[model samples]
Target: MMSDDLFETRDSSSREVFTRYNREDRIKKASEKVRQLHDPDFIRKRSFIKSVTENRGLRSVFFVIVVLVSINIAFFVTRSDKNNGRIYGIKTELKSFIYQDRALANLRLSENTKFLESLKESEEKDGALVRVNFIFLDDKGTKLSSSLQTGIYMGTELRFSSQDESGNAKKVQAEIYIKEKLLVLSSKIK
Candidate 1:
């Protein structure tokens, strides 16, 4: 024999016992609601937008790819290989020499065509001096004579006519050292 008050259910307990909707049913309902609010074409068009918004890793990868592509394009557009392709200096044919009283060595220095073209292209940008140094070496690689010349542009001829008291003419090799700004070029003439 239980008491009626003990057997009676309370209103708070009845209220606390709530019903839960099914997962599939809730998803269907939400989809229907979305379809009613937005056009089908618009939803289809924006499906990728939802995916990109939900997938953080995918979005990061896409952002990185875009940045890399942009960087590559910028590098290709702004890069120039003109300086690397330039020629620094060249040794020209030796001119005639007069060796009456002594041994005379006549030499010519010429600017490389490619170097001149590059210089012309950047003439408006900056100015630099090109120093040409001529060295005469005998068969034994001994230094016979040397001369230095400086110019902003163009080529020049070097004439060495002063002969020692011996007045003996000797076959020697000529070397030209060209210094342009920070570039150095050396060449031997036969």
Candidate 2:
């Protein structure tokens, strides 16, 4: 019983000592932290401002580059053939005609015929059948025409048809080349 009392006393005193020591250590650490916070060499305020400005500058530059690249890509995809502006003009006119008045399908078809006839002349002459192909490109790189077809006409359906020398008429290839991504490459069956 006596030994138990002694042990209890010793344990209590040790615990008290440890608690006091920890309190002193905590005070010392807090003081040191306060001193460091005020130290001139730390550059806490200046570094913070500099870092914020640098981060903002980098973010703005990145955003601007993304916007520029997107615009360039849109232009390259929609600009049509610069060499044959007439074809592009015709294409634009057809698109406008079809969309401006939903009832102008016949008018658009007639206009499309003229453009198609002009395009026939530009077909790459192969052995038996003429090959009709165009390259599509963007600021990023060559884009598949099929990829852009969804966005074309802004959710309006566009009709495409091809008539070969044998009078074999078929729907135009669903795939399109945006910037030479090889959306469609039909082989000559002849």
Candidate 3:
């Protein structure tokens, strides 16, 4: 009897216990329970938590996208300009930097030029002495009589206004400027 009772199969009589589950009955019961709750804040919090838990991958994807975009922005952004921070095209940025460097170089060159000019001017003001010799040459390039002239060294030039041995006012001639080791002379008699 005991062996037979243990081996025999019996059909369940309870409908709830025997049948497969469906969501319709569960949904209706859950909705009725939710309606009994009167607090909107509580419901909102619970729904938000449930939604976040269910769609977890969406949040991760959104976070990854945000991080990538921020990194991209960082790579292109720069504060090299001496002004308010703002984005500019790569070509425009390069041009501005190049122009700024050129301007600075030009400024330094101008300053150096001014300093040299001032030093030269000081030498001239101090009446720096210079020795000059005038050699008279004939048309055949033959050496003639030589004479000495009175002149002053004006930094790079030797200038004087003096007459010839005959003391003629019109014969006054001065040779000036031997810049960069070059000398040119042209005379016209009217």
Rank candidates by TM-score, best first. Answer: 1, 3, 2
Instruction: For residues 1-190, write the lDDT of model 2, one tens digit per residue.
Output: 2443112234544534432134334444577667566566764445644554577777687678889999999998775432211223233211111222221111011133443454446642211121223222223433323212122221122433322232221112223332223233222111
lDDT of 2 at 168: 29
| Ranked candidates, highest lDDT first | 1, 2, 3
- Superposed on all Cα atoms, the candidates' RMSDs to the truth, in angstroms, are 17.0, 18.7, 25.7
Name the candidate that leads on lDDT. Answer: 1
The clash count for each model shown is 0, 10, 0
TM-score of each: 0.32, 0.20, 0.22
lDDT of 3 by residue, 92-162 (tens): 00111122212100000001233335546554554334332333333343444334444433333223221
Q: Which model, 2 or 3, shows the larger TM-score?
A: 3
**Which scores greater on TM-score, model 1 or model 2?**
1
Please give the range of 10 consecutive residues that has the lowest summed lDDT in model 3. Answer: 88-97
Q: Please provide, for model 1 over 4-81, each residue's C-alpha lDDT reduced to its tens digit, 9 standing for 90 to 100.
A: 422343455475654343434444557765755554465444576577766789888878988999999899766421
Off by over 4 Å in 1: 1-91, 95-98, 110-114, 122-128, 136-141, 155-166, 180-190
Clashes of 1: 0
